[model samples]
Target: MADDRFSMGLFDARIKDQRHQVFKVLGMYFVLMTVAIWGLLSLFWGSTYQLESYFPSVKVYVYDFDSVATPNAVLGPAVVRYLQSTLSSPVHLGIIVRDPAGKTFDDVASEIVGEKAWGAVVINANATSNFEAAMAGTGGLLDGQWAPKGAISLVVAGARWYQVVLEYLLPYLGMYVETPVLEASHQASASFLSTATPATLGELTSAQQAALGTPFAYQEVDLRPILPGQWAGAAPLEAGLIYYIIFAFHIALFFFFSRLPLQGMTKKHGIKIRWIHVCLLRIVPVLFAYFILSLAYTLINKAFLLPTDGNGYASFGPQAGFMVLWMLDWIALASLGLAMEAMLTLLTLKFFPLFLITWILSNITSSFFPATLAPKIFRYGYMMPFWHCTTATKHIMWGTRNRLGLNFGVLLGWCGVSLVTICLFELMWRRIEERKERQESAKDVEGQGAHK
Candidate 1:
């Protein structure tokens, strides 16, 4: 007979049994993956759910320097009243009315630069007096005529949280505060103009007449601007973070594969290698590999012309910034990769994808959205690697805040924890493998005895 085992009929009983076993395994895997995917989806979606409800956490200071205006000026008080009324609404920001006493515009600007506040609204000093003087044509001339842009200033640090400032905070301020204040100021100016004498009106130049019609104009000042073409440099802090994690995982994987030949030499060729040496081999090479990979990664960014020098946006000089960024990438890779290496030893290739999904989702959620705009539970993001990395990267690229010490400390802490876990897990994995080999040896001895 031909090889019946290898050439079974379509309806053979053996074929039916094998097909059934394959289907059962596939069904189990499908169900497990479905549940795992649902859980990960919930985690990512929950981070951004009802995000607007947490808007109050993003604080903005509104200081009315024009509060003690001349008796006739209603612009400053009217704007303050309108902004205060918004505090009662369900969807309102943390609009704090700061005491202007002992505080100047420079002070408020400094506070924003220091990351003390997200943004600020300042009604300039002598705002009402200046408007009154301009309307009466009595103020000192500029460029041979008196003309002011506005009495109010909207100060922001756009590079702090670029998307949030542009999308939520700026729009909210425009809708609730700026629009009504401008309308009320225009109405008040028109009323004042309607009652003015011709002599007073004629004394006003064309510019002064126009200024009287809109006496409450406002100027927007972004302290730390995220200028055009700078988003390339910011990539590592955003979606590039996810890519970095993936690269780190692959680096661990590449090393894992590279070890197979050494294992083959030890097992098939009887080459002696100590277990402790093997463990060290796994970790020490990873550090060197990350150092080189990080240098390449930083160089790629530089090749793309991502600004590294102190271009008024960053404080570090050209070569110094590049060195700092390379060091950061090296630590980040080690922190992220070492943990995956530890987990891989325990979970093995079969189940590692489940852990990988959770790791990516958790880090991305924390880094992509500002904790201030998310639920209180997300405050833990402060401890996550991605959040610190993003914060530090922004500071390096855009000079947002100087927290390098804290950032480096946290990243190094992660590396230490991962290093410990890797060693312990590697030892455990070797113990399990040795136990399996001993069991197989015992079985072989019994079979040989039975054969005799």
Candidate 2:
């Protein structure tokens, strides 16, 4: 009995030593592999979507309803030219002038929505006459006062890209219009100071007041609105919800995957279960957590950002679609993660590979900016699950256009690939483990012989 107890103790010690050796080798290999991959990715795909790295360029369609003799023709061409010159390289203009006056705002809007141009500048037929009237202090709320009326209409796409374009263009255009008006006002003021009369003094002051700002009062029209009216004010909440939903899945993934090894080890000894069944069992909790979190997130967003007095879930088509897409996305990502973890464990039992993989995927996902804006070298990011996931999420929440079918295809493709890879690697691992066990048996016999 004492001999059997001693042998059991020795066997346990050997197993512990083998585990220590496995971990030591895996730790070193994981570190080296992670560093090598990270270095290569950074070298090839340098930071691509930085605002400071490049200036923003916009496509503009200009429609002039005024004839060559009118101020619209002169001012419209001049404004377009100024815009072309003012925006520096990497931020240059692509301006097209449409001649036909029949093109309506809807035509321009459709084009903008279709990604033809960032904005359209529409010069009304009455623009020149209106400008003249405003300058003459006639046909406006200004009975005797001089308040300029806007003649041109600025129709801009309401996407994030167009917002950036407008931020660069609008100020410069305003300054261009105001500069001439101010110069004329200054000249008039100087002229009137020398020849002082009651009428002249009033004229001088009126001219100065009118020229203090832009003479043109352009009306801004939104081509695409995320929410009805201006939702730019709620940008923070919108963005927060996106990040929250994404990271919530990520967090759940991290928590559940960490216990996967323990789950495998603690399987009932007498019961025989298929590997796929085991995988499905593990996935159930992740799905439950994901659904609950998704529901909570939707409730919060509706309560604050998209609040309606009635039942929010009644008109929850988009939200339901978003949830289904999110579920597929997380599942694909989780499957991919599992496959990677299994492959890495076969090579090295350390958890460092999981971290490395997660970190790399997070970087390339391009959640902060549109993947289109990313560098050409980083175009592989388009195939990543999270990129499509975030994109589909944006489309659902903010009403942005996206290829939902394509996104779904990409995610499912990843899942199929991962499951296949995991199966192959797991089979390979079983063979490798068998070989190692046989080798260990041989060593044990040799050690016994040496002891004898």
Candidate 3:
């Protein structure tokens, strides 16, 4: 904390112990940046291009059967072609054959629902005019049985994709009857209104008549925006993948810089500086360098799947912000490594344990695979700096607000902890160097006294 030490410590050390091949370090960093950034971007870009071209999403299936209709007896294929032509080319429907002899109408209906087919049309043998009258009008009889005069029964499957398609296309795609669905009559104001009315036919214990009311309401749910654009697979994964690789390299650079110089490399002027300062001092340049590479790849390789509203500047800006925040994980990891290195440097015992922690943290947090692929409670590194940060990358790239707050908080916390750790380690490292000087000076004095 002395004024002279403040002004001269790192500066005097840099000038005195400067390497003849400091040129070599710059060269190594260039080779590293070029190879690491170029190779990853190339491989990822190609993979993304091929996958997008090969796969088309959203497949639809339809089944239409007519036993009673004298006209257009084979209606299934025509219906399939019509539906396919109505929707986009990628949205396709295949016909499923249903023989009147093989299964009953209801049995085939159940099969349509069970096979995960989107919907089925059934045209029974009794094509009576009273079918519509049976369906409406106080449950009137059509050939002595009940249903709308022209209504045909449709059994439809409801799943994520099926429902998403059905919500919009169902109204326009299905077979046309005057009534979209058959409505049953029920009594409104009476004792049966609460529960005494039949909830199901099998559960009915008493007979009851009820008035039926019908006012049609329809629904359609679509997740895409008004101006739909698609992004998927490797394109979306690129930002995080680069962040991981750069972060890993940064970690290795930190450790390598902190390593002791080759033996017998001491300077002539009695000035000694440990390797920790080399790593810490270069943080600014290293960050700027990594950011420049990231910006280059993002702008050049449009192949990376980014989910965006397509503001080029917004994508570039947020991506840069994400990279800076992502870098914090490794930077914090390096600081923790430096603190451990300071302890190991003083001990002069086994260094393997220190190296082990450094190596493991680098690999495990690198996002070659994400932390979430395992259970939430991973024992190996549940507490480390990058664990939560990689998770945040997924949320951020998803262009959702889902864990943005949590990810930012945890990463910022790691940075806070790492800063405190570096300050303490710097103080400890300086004391160790000063103590070594005192011991060497004492030995020299003793030698002089002996010679006298």
lDDT of 1 by residue, 1-452 (tens): 78756786667785798888888989988998898778888877888899899888878898887765455556667778888888899998888888888887889988997888888877776667776676666772356554454577788988888878887877787776666567766776877778988887778778676666666667688887877876676678788888888988888789889988878878887555776887789789999999998898888888877766535656678789888888988898888888898888888887777777878888888887888877777788888889888887777777777788999999999999988888888788778878998999999999999999
- Residue-level lDDT of model 2, residues 111-226, one tens digit each, is 76566766677655554454444444554325555444445666765543433545654544445445433443344345435565667446744544463333444566655444
Over 1-452, each residue of candidate 3 has an lDDT whose tens digit, in order, gives: 55765575544556654653666767876786577557545532433243222222222333343333334332233333444454454433333444455556556545543434445555443322222222233333434433332334444433212223344335533533222232211111221245433543235222112112221111222221112233342332334444444454554355445544522255445565554664355344444544555455444333454433222212335656456434544444343343344444433333334444343444343333322222333334445444454444333333322344565566556546544554565567668878988999999999999999
Residue range with the least summed lDDT across 10 consecutive positions in model 3: 208-217
Cα-based lDDT for every prediction: 0.80, 0.53, 0.40
User: Between candidates 1 and 3, which one is better according to TM-score?
Assistant: 1
In TM-score terms, which candidate is top?
Answer: 1
Listed in order, each prediction's TM-score against the native is 0.91, 0.63, 0.37
> Which is the better candidate, 2 or 3, if ranked by TM-score?
2
- In terms of lDDT, model 3 sits at 0.40
Q: Which whole-number lDDT from 0 to 100 does residue 172 have in model 3?
A: 37
Candidate with maximal lDDT: 1
Candidates' RMSD to native: 2.9, 7.9, 18.5
